[model samples]
Target: MPATATRADRSPRAAEPSPRGGRMGALWRVLEGPRALDVAALLIGVCTAVLTVLGLVMVLSSSSVEAIGSTDGSYGLFRRQAMWAVGGLAALLVLRRLPLRVLKGLAWPAFGLAFLLLSLVAFTSLGHSVGGNTNWLRIGGFTMQPSEAAKLAMALWAAAVLERKGRLIRHVHHALVPVLPFGLVLVVLVLLGRDLGTAIILTGILATILFIAGTNRKVFIAFAALAATVATAMVLLAKNRLVRVQAWLFGCEGLETSGDPCFQPDHGIYALASGGWWGVGLGQSRQKWSYIPEAENDFIFTILGEELGLVGSLAVLAAFLGLAVGMYALAARTTSPFIRLTTWGIMAWLVGQAFVNIAMVTGLLPVIGVPLPFISYGGSALTLALAGVGVVLAFARHEREALRREGAPDAPTPDPSVRPQETR
Candidate 1:
């Protein structure tokens, strides 16, 4: 150099001048720091807590009238949900503390059990039908939905299998062989139980796993087409499903009579329309007073919209969005295939199901009986969802430990003195 610059003149602090820009820069630095994953994990946990608590509140409000009429008291459904929540929290704690390998080892056994349960639900006298779907199993005094458990089992099993397949996942044969067959068996069993909604969700989870594993684009396209065709056929064959689809396509206007195919959908829209920007006020929803069917279960989002208004509904959406972002960030940052794939599968299951439920509530999609994740009043669904979150937390914990052991540094600083070279 003709003249060397002074240390003060070459200081990096001289780079920026605007206070707003400086603040933004600092924010970005913090976000990009080594504790980014920690922040993500915290975000995930917070969103889950917020959603679950909100769900409990909404469930209590929505189910009060029905509970008072049918069960012990106004707090009957709420008490049952609280008990399930305790059980689910226990599951979360246990799974979160388990080693990743232990989780992986449980994959096959879990899948086998799910398969066996699904088989029993579909083909045996032990199956219980609710809302015309024989997807539940009653043992003694307890009733549980095998389809819900199958979702978690499917995710875990797919993650374990796809990760083990390694680069061979790119090959069509390896990608479709065991994974597709097993997934189809589960889907078929679910369909046999007449639970099309759960079957669609299961298909989605399987497809998500394959996509995350880097399956060929053409194969994915073909698989999607096949799934669509099969779903269409199922809808066409089932008169009840066909009627629901017709009601959705045309309008549910003037079809509010109870027992009509459009009764639930019509009332759902009415509830949402009643809740303007501020809503009708919590626990004040008239729709939940024996108007909308399954107000505490599949159609709970409508009750939520009616009570909390648009702002509350949007807040719920935001929490789910945060959950998605945190889970996706964790998956992206992790180097292990199992961690990444499993996180993505769980993300798709929970987030995807939430959107499906919301869309159904908003009438953007036909009324499918999929429950909103962490929000719907279903013991089996809530328990399994929390258990899945626990699995994700375990992965996040493992990643943090790996980072700590490696002595990972903060975001790398760019060299101020490095000059750009001209290219010919």
Candidate 2:
């Protein structure tokens, strides 16, 4: 017929592989799209959904005992957790629809609000102390952790500030002036609560944003050293925290003794070890029966290991890893510098905090009382973390649309038999 039809004249779809090799291959074709942004957004959605479901199941299982003893029944805690999950999901949906211009416009007020709330927690009668950290504020019958909100606010604020500073970022003073003042202020307030874990996470976010903004190596180093010195000084000034550091270093040997400060770590290890490879079976963890402290909060990893074994533990790790990879890919592919900087800052914050939580649980690092992100049971932390994930998703969507406008390859097309409109 067209006996000499050239390759260039052939339809581009003719030579493409069919999505029929295997289940995994099909999934691969779908996820490995023409543009990385679409794939990343897809991955973030899938991971967030799976993690949220897993978190709810685990929270119900782990909190049943405490809920029954203190409240109406086992479902008491589960109900509250479910409500928080619903609220968080709603927040995510709403955040996804907001335009980037609106987000940028709100950055300053968000930062100021974050600061005011943090100040109230740190310095006013509104502060509520729990488990040795005065980081919560009780306002008008509602209890909220201001630091969690501050983390998201600061990320937005820093991106806007640094993106505007653009070329001026090469100068040390311009790089440090506004961000350092505002960032260090929020961090200092976090430290005022003696919540060192949250403080470290906030500082990590700040450092990551600075690095992404292209601050000079020498200036960054000096800033890092100053931060480290301040952190060390704060730790040394607090007796309980120094004791925790000491226990982390040399107290494992005395774990079997009653009243030892290492009891928590020792129990955490036992819980993990008890699960072997297949786990003790979901909801059957012995450690949840008053063995591991805060089993539904900071130390939830221990219960996760005990109930779901190494496989479940690794699944959580993998989900976080997927999120990190997806966010980083978006950061690299986006044309907008603010999007790039903000995505990287968020990727660092969530992924770094996740590993920090895991490390503390596995005894690879000192216990820092940091939650395991999407898998933890706390209300404020879960809600804010979900909101951050939503922001990243929004950015990914923007990039995908922008790429399409530039005539970049579209996402995978569907079969006309199944989705006729997608055939074009």
TM-score of each: 0.88, 0.87
Q: For residue 302, what is the lDDT in candidate 2? A: 89
Off by over 4 Å in 1: 1-31, 252-258, 408-424
Report the lDDT of model 1 for residue 310. Answer: 93
- State which candidate has the highest TM-score: 1
lDDT of 2 by residue, 222-318 (tens): 8889888987897799877777788888875644433566878889999999988889999899988877876888788889899899999889988
Local distance difference test, candidate 2? 0.82
Candidate 1 lDDT over 1-424, as tens digits, reads: 1334432224332233324457656643443456667877898999999999999999899988877766479988888898898899999999999998899999999999999999988888889999899999988788999999999999999989998899999999999889999889999999999899999999999999999899988779889899999999999998788778878898655554345877788789899889999899998999998898669998998899998899999999999998997897688667778888888888989999999999987889998789998889999999999999999999989878876654536735446677557999
Q: Which parts of model 2 have CA positions greater than 4 angstroms off?
A: 1-33, 252-259, 408-424
In angstroms, how far off is 284's CA in candidate 1?
1.0
lDDT of 1: 0.86
Cα deviation at 130, candidate 2, in Å, is 0.3
